[model samples]
Target chain A: MWQLYQFPLCPFSRKVRLLLGEKGIGYEPVRESPWLRRDEFLDLNPTGQVPVMVDTDRGVALIDSTVICEFFEETVDKAAMLNGTAVDRAEIRRLVVWFDSNFFRDITAPLLEERMIKRLVHRTAPDARALRDAMKAAVGHLDYIDYLLDHRTWLAGPTMSLADLAAAAQISIADYLGGIDWKSHEQAKRWYVGMKSRPSFRPLLSERMDGIPPPSDYDKLDD
Target chain B: MWQLYQFPLCPFSRKVRLLLGEKGIGYEPVRESPWLRRDEFLDLNPTGQVPVMVDTDRGVALIDSTVICEFFEETVDKAAMLNGTAVDRAEIRRLVVWFDSNFFRDITAPLLEERMIKRLVHRTAPDARALRDAMKAAVGHLDYIDYLLDHRTWLAGPTMSLADLAAAAQISIADYLGGIDWKSHEQAKRWYVGMKSRPSFRPLLSERMDGIPPPSDYDKLDD
Candidate 1:
C-alpha cells in the first residue's frame, strides 16, 4: 500500500493523486495542510511539502511530484504512461516543468494566494497590487496555454501524460476559485473539458472546499 | 554528434555540459545569449531557453536541463554515469530537482541577478536588502546541502551521480560571481574542491567571459 500525504487543493499533490488513480494504484490519502506543519508530516518529508509518497511495500518515501510520477511510471505494470520515444519523454518532461514553474507562479499562485489562501488563513489577505499583478500574469499564462493547445491535441503530445495532469490540477483549482475565463480561450477550454472528464480526474472535480464553490461546469465533466 | 545550445555561465546549461563530459559524449557547443534569440533557436525551443540539446543521430531536440540529463542517462552507457537502481535513480532525480529549485532560486539567482546581470546588462544593482535576503536563503540552502553531504559521501548515494554535477555547476557559477562564502561551509567547500579537479570540469573552469574576471581561486580546482 502507498501512503500519500496531500493537500486537496495543492496542484502538485493533485497531480500525483491523478497519476495513482490512472494507474489503478490504491493508496491511503493523509490529509495535510502544508502551512500548518504536523510532526508526523515533517517526519514523512523533512522538506515539509506534499504530496510525499510513502511506498509501504518498499518502505521508501519519495518527495517531489515529478519524481513520484516518474517512479509510478517505472514501477506500475500498466502500459507506460510516458508516451513515444526518448524525445517524446523529453517533451513531456519539459511541459511538466513549464506547468510547474510558469503556470504555477503566473496563474495558480496568484489565484490561490489572492482568492483562496487569503480567505482561508485568518492573517493572510490579498494584496490589492499583488492581486492585480496576479490577474495580469494569469492572463498571460492562459494566452500561452491557448497557443500551445491550438496546435496539439494534448499539452505535450497526442497521448495524455503527467504533463496534462499537472496543468489540469492547476486549472481545476483555478476553476474552483472562479479564476478562469474559459469563454475567451476556445482551444484551452476544449482541452480542459476533455481533461476534466477523465475517470482519473473525477476525484478532483468532486473535491469541494469548506466555503469555496467551483464554477457551474465543475461537476459537468463533459462540459 | 550532439549539439548543445548553451551559454558558459548558465548553471542549467553547465549541468548538461558536465553530464555529457562525464559520460564521455562528444557534442558541439553552440553559444547563445538568452537575450538575443535567433530564429533558428526559437524554432528549436519556443521558450527560447538555453541548454537545448539537438540529438543529431536521433533527429530530436531535448530541452530543460533535467530532462536532457535523463535523456543521456537512458540513451548512453549506464555505467559511465548516473549509477544505481530504479529507486536510486529516483533519488538522484529528486536531488537534481532540489538543486534546480531550492539552490538556484535562493543562491545562484540572487548572486547572478545582483552581481553579474546588473553589471553585464547595465541594470541597477540588486538592493542591499534583497542581497541580504538572498544570502539568508543561501545559508539555509547550504545548511541543507551540508547535512546531506555529512550523512552520505555523495549526494543521493555513495556513488557520485548527476546530483553532484548539478550542484557543482550551480556552485561553480556562484563561486565565479563571488556569491559563495566557502569558509562558512567546510564540508561543502571540500567536496566542491574535489569536484572542480575532475578532468570533466576543466572546460568549465577554463571558460572565460569576454570582460569578466573570476575570483582569485576560480581556477584552483583544489581550493
Candidate 2:
C-alpha cells in the first residue's frame, strides 16, 4: 500500500486524497506536519511539502500533489479526472493551477497563516485585518468560480475534472479557517455542496486540526 | 502556430520557451507584461499572467506555463522533455515544480522585483538588503543544484527533461539580474553553461528587457 504523508488541513494533500479516493487507489495516511519540517520527511521529499505518496516496499516516493495526481492518472484508468483531448486537458490543468496557486495564495495561505499557523504555532491571536483581507479575497474567488460555472457544467467543462477537486480542496481549507462567506455566492456554494457530498470529500471534512474548529456549516452539504 | 504571450524577464515564460524550443515547436512571441494586467490580456487570461499559448484559429488558449508545457508535450512528440516511465516523470515534475515555485520564490522573483520592477515601474532603487538576501539564497539554490548534479546526468535523471529546462530558465533570469554567483558550484555552473549554450537558450539571452540590462557576462557561454 502507498503511504500518503499528509496533514488534515493541507489543501494540497486534500487534493491528492480526493483523487486517490475517486480512483479507488488505496493508501495508508501517514500524518505529516510539514510546518514542523521533520528531518525524516525532508529526506523523503527535499522540498518538505506534504501530499507525498510513499510505497516503502517498492521504494518509490512521489512528491508534489500534482505529481501524485498525474502519476495515478497515468497508471490507473478508472474515473479519469484529467479527461478528454489535449485542449480540454489544458483547460482542466489551467484551472488546477488557478486554484492551487492563485486561490491558495490569496485566500487559503493567508487564512492558514492568520487563523491556523499563528494560533497553533506562535500561540498568538489571529490578525483581524489579515482575516478580513482573506475573506474579501474569497468573495472575488467565488465570483470567478460563479463566472466559470455560468458556462460549463462543472468547474472546467462538461465533465468533472481534477480542476473541481483542486478548487474544492483550497476552498474547503479556506472555509475551515472561516475565510469563506457564502452570501451572494450561491452558484459557487451549490457547486461546492455537490463536491462536499462526494465520498472522497467526506473523510476530509470530518478530519479536524487540533485547536482549530471549523465554522458550524463547514461540513454540511446544505448550508 | 501558437502565439506565446511573454516578457523577456519572466522565468515562467522562459521555461515554456525552452520547452517549445527543445520540442522543435515554433511560436510567435507576443510581448505581454503581466504586471501591467491589461484588460485585453486579462480577457485572454483572467489571471493576467504571461507564458500563455494561444491558437487563435482554434480559439484555444493554454494558460499557465506548466499547463502550456503539458499541452505541447502531449501534442508534440519530437523532443519529449518529459521523457521516461511514470515514476521518472513524477521525479521530473517534482523538480519542475521545485524550480518553478521554490527557486523562483527564493531567488528569481525577488531579484526581478528588486532589480527589474523597482527600476522600471516603481522608479525606486532596489533594496540592498533584499538584493543581498536573494543573492544569498541563490548560493544555497546553486548548492542544491550541485548536489542534484552529483547523482544524475540531468536534474531529474539520466535523460534531460523539462526539469532541466525549468531550472535553466529560472537560473538564467536570476543570472541576468546578477543574483547568481557561480563560485564553488562547479557542477551546477557546468550544467548551466551547457544549458545556456543550447540553441533554445540563445534567443532568450539575446532578447533584452527594456531599461534593465543584464550583467556583462550574461550571454557568454564560456564565461
True contacts kept of each: 0.64, 0.95
> lDDT of each structure?
0.81, 0.92
Model 2 alpha-carbon drift over 4 Å, by segment: none
Superposed Cα deviation of residue A145, candidate 1 (Å): 4.5
State the lDDT of candidate 2 residue by residue for A86-181, as single tens digits.
Answer: 999999999999999999999999999998889878999998998899899999999999999999999999999999999999999999988889
Q: Mind giving the per-residue lDDT tens digits that candidate 2 earns over B65-127?
A: 999889889989989988889999999999999999999999999999999888888999999
Report the error of model 2 at residue B39, Å: 1.0
Model 2 global lDDT (CA atoms, 0 to 1) = 0.92
lDDT of 1 at A135: 62
Interface RMSD of each candidate, angstroms, one decimal: 1.3, 0.5
* Regions of model 1 farther than 4 Å from truth: A56-58, A122-151, B36-43, B55-59, B78-80
Task: Give DockQ: model 2.
Answer: 0.93
